[model samples]
Target: MKNFISVVVTLFAVSFAKAQIPAGYYDAATGLTGYSLKTKLKEIVTNGHQDKGYGGLWDAYKVGDLDKFYENDNTILDIYSEKPAGPDAYSYTPVTDQCGGTTPGSEGGCYNREHLFPQGFFSSASPMRNDYHHVMPTDNVVNGKRNNYPFGTVGTASWTSTNGSKLGVSSFPGFLGIVFEPIDEFKGDVARSLLYFITRYEDDLQTFNYSDVNNPQDGSKNRGFD
Candidate 1:
């Protein structure tokens, strides 16, 4: 019993240490926090300029020109390549027909960039906008199916995309299996992104959907679209 207890304690410590965030990963000086963060993001979308020639956040991230928060690398490609294996491995399938495609003359076959954090709610801010940590290339039709519905697990998908992605239900086994697809390498990144969003926008959290698992922190009291 004594040996077992000792091993358990050691394991717990190791897990906790692995999950700790490094200091300075999210400094405001990176020009992504406070008023500066807001100002630069506004410049990107003023006067419907974004809708004209703007290629969305993914295009901006590829060029490392998302407002002012530039990434040190092609973090999205790195994350996708390094994703985990087994049942948890990132699954890529054709999004359903309803979502459509972007490639010319291809009909609806290719995947489109997906924002794990939906663009509609954030007003498509640049800092969070082009972050590869949350952006995924998924089927465009499936994206349309998802629309702005809050994430959740269900027995059936209420809607299905052209390629096959569905918005009805999540198949994950977690307590609140709100299904989200993150590449294998970036599971930790997704978790951290959620933590950041919660902390930074703690005041507006309630406005968004809050599952027992997704938004576990309740100490702060602000809400966003749900």
Candidate 2:
């Protein structure tokens, strides 16, 4: 939903790591396929869904968003600002660097919650608004620059962050809209997050507003996935 339509297609990258899904999570959908499998998954995934509210995300990030892989410095591992090959241009301590509303004038200012699926489409509704799976801590300026654009393959970048994430016109076929392209290392994270959003919120997908995307007409059933 949420102008995230293009992401459903651009999600070919392999996840950097895979978590162990709950033991019986997909057992119900085992023999299903196509829409049937999708329906079963909707039931399977949404069964125990809970909303921790918006405040809980900060606490969740403390466990889920820390830097343990690359620099191993225990700073915030921001996908939009992380430079894996060498040192990061800047880094944030978990709580100390969390931003309020004001964004820094530069790239490495402060980190804030970035909704991969965006909150605007659903009017910032519950569960979806606070879904820790899709809401991630990212640099304030880069997050602002991403500004709800659908993730896609960029042909020509209008702007690029220090880590090479881009805000650009789509190079992907069948779409010419503006898109934000995250770096290769994090593309799978973006893809998986968006897919989780779709599955988790399948019932509400039809109602999300996609008018903000380039071709408002594609906001309906197919959700700009043409």
Candidate 3:
């Protein structure tokens, strides 16, 4: 899963970097390295970003969240239930399978927008709450199980999803709260998504929730675990 997931993420990253970037988008950072490159990237990522509002995420999924890599059926690519090498445990149609007021008691019932950064951290503020880069369509029940927990390796899972994602106490050092661990197939995607979120919102991260004592912030603007 690590090798395959890494390849997939690398391909996606390379493709987006090469094709989606507008001409001269990185012209300012040409020949930059180290802190110079980092500063330029933050400038590039933060500028011209628009807030689409929370409702727009549902519409965005029709084009952005389809299962094009696996199953190839154009269903929602739910990380919590997707089996990359075989048929999924279940599938969801774009609009028809979206969650309403009631959430499923189990997996495969309906899908909802999951904030990879956890919306509560920022109090569900605009732009961050609606960002397509981190907000993904996922099984409602599994998303509830994830709740606001940080991602980590689980020691003993209290609950497991159909695709083997776990919700349990953390094996990661420093932090000892229950954490959600996605299957290995999606770890790269999750990591890259979080990196993008932090870079794009670097200016605002200091204002986010920071009540956890174990996870300390760097003296610089970036958040980190000590």
Candidate 4:
């Protein structure tokens, strides 16, 4: 069943290879690739993106994943609970303390609205803070462990998710700092997500504090996967 699900997901991605944008969306950037192609996509997507509010994400982000989320399991495709590691998955119940934890910032106190991109680097600016594209649902404890660390291979795990997502130093060359490494099963999903954030926010990146395509914290480039 897991293999079947994986195949289905792969097919879904393959289908996207032939994706079409609305009429004339990239007519100007036809045949463009690399930086130029990305530039055009940035203009196209940014132009159409709606700056939704932070409050709206709870209701909004769960659109496609609600059914997939096992409420009793206390997760939303949680990497910490997948397997080969998961035993004590942090729950995602939202009724008690929303906006995540305010203190003791190392464990899951409430459902966490994680920024795929660190908010501190961006100074919690609007659109980025409110943008659902970059933020995601995670446990407050797991989220805190991830903190502002960049994603990379964890050679020596100081912390680990039940499913094997890790928080530690970067063993994956190019980037050699503390970083978060989601489990293998979710690596592709994470990559796709971060890429979308970069592509969608390319233009506005110049105004932000850190805009490096790789290692946004230090402007050092690194491979997306280990």
Provide the lDDT at 54 for model 2.
95
lDDT digits (tens) for residues 70-186 of candidate 1 = 232323222322323322122233222212434433323444566666756556655555554345554444555555544444456565432233354566564444443433344
How badly does each model clash, as a count of residue pairs? 32, 0, 0, 5
Comparing 1 and 2 by TM-score, which wins? 2
| Candidate 4 residue lDDT tens string, 1-226 | 3342334334334434557545765576566554555556557667867876878777764553332433334344445444533334454444444453365454445555788777776678888888876677766677878888787788999888666788888898776778898888767766666666666665555555664343353332221111
After superposition on all CA atoms, what RMSD does each candidate show versus the true structure? 12.0, 4.3, 4.4, 6.8
lDDT of all the models against the reference? 0.41, 0.78, 0.78, 0.61
Question: How much does candidate 2 score in TM-score?
Answer: 0.86
lDDT score, candidate 2: 0.78
Worst 10 residues of 3 by lDDT: 217-226
For candidate 4, the per-residue lDDT at 216 reads 57
- Per-residue CA lDDT of candidate 2, range 1-226, in tens? 4335333323412332256566765577665545455556557667887888999999998998899999888899999999889888999999999997775899878899999887887889987999998999999999999987888889989999999999999998888989999999998888678676775677777777766664222343333233
- Give the candidate order by descending lDDT: 3, 2, 4, 1
Residue pairs clashing in model 2 are: none
Cα shift from native, residue 118, model 1 (Å)? 2.0
User: Which scores higher on TM-score, 3 or 4?
Assistant: 3
lDDT of 3 by residue, 1-226 (tens): 2353344335435636845777777688677554455556668877888788898999999998899888889999999999887788899999999999886787889999999888887788888999998999999999998888888899999999888999999998876888899999998778777766765776777787767532333424533222
CA shift of 220, model 1, Å:
5.4
C-alpha positional error of residue 60 in candidate 3 after TM-score superposition, expressed in Å: 0.9
